[model samples]
Target: MKLKLLSITLLLTLAACKSHAPDASGPGTAIDPPIRPNPRLAAATGFDFYLLNLSWSPEYCHSHPEAAECASHSTFVLHGLWPQNKDGSYPQNCGNGPGSQTGPDASRFSDIYPEPGLLEHEWRTHGTCSGLSANDFFSAARSAYQSVKIPSQLTNLSSQTSLSPEQIAALFTQATPGLSRESIAISCGHNYLTAVAICLNKSLHPIACPAVRSCRANSVRIAPPR
Candidate 1:
């Protein structure tokens, strides 16, 4: 009788253990570990150079006529200073560092980043990865903008003009004493000249752009400011 009782107790213990055992194949049974942040996303200061994008306002305004910057009839407007890798890959939207805020002082940057939305977007996307505070980043952007001299031919275009990518780059290099053909790259959209991207070092000096593809069109139209 004692042996039978002992056997029943062992069976009961085995059933209890089986019931408590975790289900290996059951859906939603396992708790996944928290996801770790990507190391590339956290690399604020790890960049090869800076690409200062200057948007040709007329070309952009052709599509986005309602943009506030278009209202000013500017020539080349500040796009954003991007952190670029030597291989042409860039890091963007690095989430706020310790105590860092994504929103910059819009009013302070209004002259350059006329659209408040763009100001916030640039700061959140490109500016955060700059490893500088919003104010300092924008300040560096302003300085970078001032460094590039716009050729008179491009500054006061009352009518449309067509120029090859090489010619456009040449004009820039001629106008800007230190700028070189290798350091600048042109971007186009819908066969229209769009933006000029100039590569600069961390110190904001002109540098050679690595692995960047320039506009391939034989010729692109430059629209007049509206």
Candidate 2:
């Protein structure tokens, strides 16, 4: 038994020595073979995520008082807004941080990305824009659903005033020019995308005006100021 153990120990030592053995090619001068493409690395490095801020067209909403009033008051309506992409970046403005109630607000209604249902409701009730394209609206809606950011200015809006949808739409119109109620609702949809690009945050995710969302991981919750 002792001899057998000795033999086994000797074999293990030999294996260890072989593993730590120096290369005949020399030390640092040894050339390494080319690295092969790894599927795992490729997958880890490859993926697609879209994010941005949606802006509202206050000018158009203002001119159309009827619609403006409706939009302002509606709780869930996405009105008079556009996507802001001032800086070019993916997951645009995912975490823009918080805003102070003081000082001039960056377009109070600037945040407020709503869902399709609320948008349609606002159109039907305030702008008489029910005839607008649902496809375009959905494109924007889905973008918001993926993530929503409410700016601090809008937080004040929610707290200070409960304007009717029409008033809300009107307020938007007041901010813009060369736009009518009929055209504003339809055009605003496109504007939303443009606005998002403008106001996008520096991060890879969309900036939550009130809160940022990390959809692939964690989600942010922005509370409207009281």
Candidate 3:
């Protein structure tokens, strides 16, 4: 009986050892990291942000200078990225995805306003393409984005500034206001909000941004103009 037990033990140990053996496959056969288009080096091929080789070029302002001036109450500032598409040489939508517009212009809601970079924690936790509700998504976007609210008074901000998208982003980093017009552009897609929210949440305050509607509902009511 003792001999039989000892044999069983040895067999078990040997099986365990074999199961734990590492693969002897060739080097570099391990799992590789997924490749993504380099955000920095990739050409701005979409209307999402990159347009005419420039970032944050608001088309409405470029087309109607007088309206822009009235809205911002100051001369528009231009930041360099790329000029709007000229001569109609580019595709109607940027090559990145569907719904991209091509032209030498942009609307007030051209880019994702309030800038990106909020909601890092939630995004890191949930990851991309999770089946979250629109309400939850909006909340998460706000929390991650760390964006400032657009004042109700700044109606013309959309067409007022000529600053490039990159320049607009820089201004946001410094807490400068009166530049961003739309606050947030939903047509750019939810990922735009997700990306910006994550970026802002990571860059700015560690604390998440509270829900906008919830705050408004609970606060004192401001009557609309008579």
Candidate 4:
């Protein structure tokens, strides 16, 4: 895993350097590469897969009832769209963060993220590493979420129930085109289903991500949105 991450990082750096053309301002002067105080902050794009995390809003509200998100009921809300490596290595804060950095036009972020703070945090932590602008990052996240056809039964769920992780995965396969049970993973907390994750390629097409953790319980209780 370390080796793979290191290789990708190096490749991205080389790619960035390759983009700089020879100095044209001076006829005979050679341009020495500027030294970056923190190389990780340099813009670079490297990722093996996209992990679309769908947080079950009801479960989140149940645990953090005081949270702003708990004020309203939504069946499913985006947790994040993460760039992941096959070896389980991922990037974060790869470029400028929220303070001095301008991120994606977040006017529409509320539609997906429910919480305003989460939108900024996700851009700083994960979106920065995507080697894409904040707008592109958030747009990609939204598009990825829309690509999946969640099972209607789960979308309008209103009551608590129990089901195995495999059962959930099977339902997703039946719902989304070209998606398989192998592509979905269910997450749980305190014996309750908390989230569902699906893997996609950089282009947002369904793909298998390695080492995805799934709920191990034989069955987990589900909390429906109010």
How many steric overlaps does candidate 4 have? 2
Clashing pairs in model 1, backbone N/Cα/C closer than 3 A: none
Which residue pairs clash within candidate 4?
104-134, 104-135
Best by lDDT: 1
Mind sharing the TM-score for model 3? 0.22
List ranges where model 3 is wrong by over 4 Å.
1-128, 142-146, 149-161, 164-166, 176-226
Model 1: per-residue Cα lDDT over 36-128, one tens digit each? 222332334768787778878787667667667777888888877778888657776676642255467888877787666666656766777
lDDT of 4 at 79: 74
Error of 2 at 74 (Å): 6.2
Per-model C-alpha lDDT, please?
0.69, 0.25, 0.22, 0.64
Model 2 segments more than 4 A misplaced: 1-53, 72-140, 143-146, 158-226
Root-mean-square deviation of every model: 22.6, 29.3, 26.4, 15.9
Worst 10 residues of 3 by lDDT: 19-28
Residue 58, model 4, lDDT: 84
Off by over 4 Å in 1: 1-44
What is residue 69's positional error in candidate 4, in angstroms? 3.3
- Provide the lDDT at 3 for model 1: 20
Scored by lDDT, model 2 comes in at 0.25
- Best to worst by TM-score, what's the order? 1, 4, 2, 3
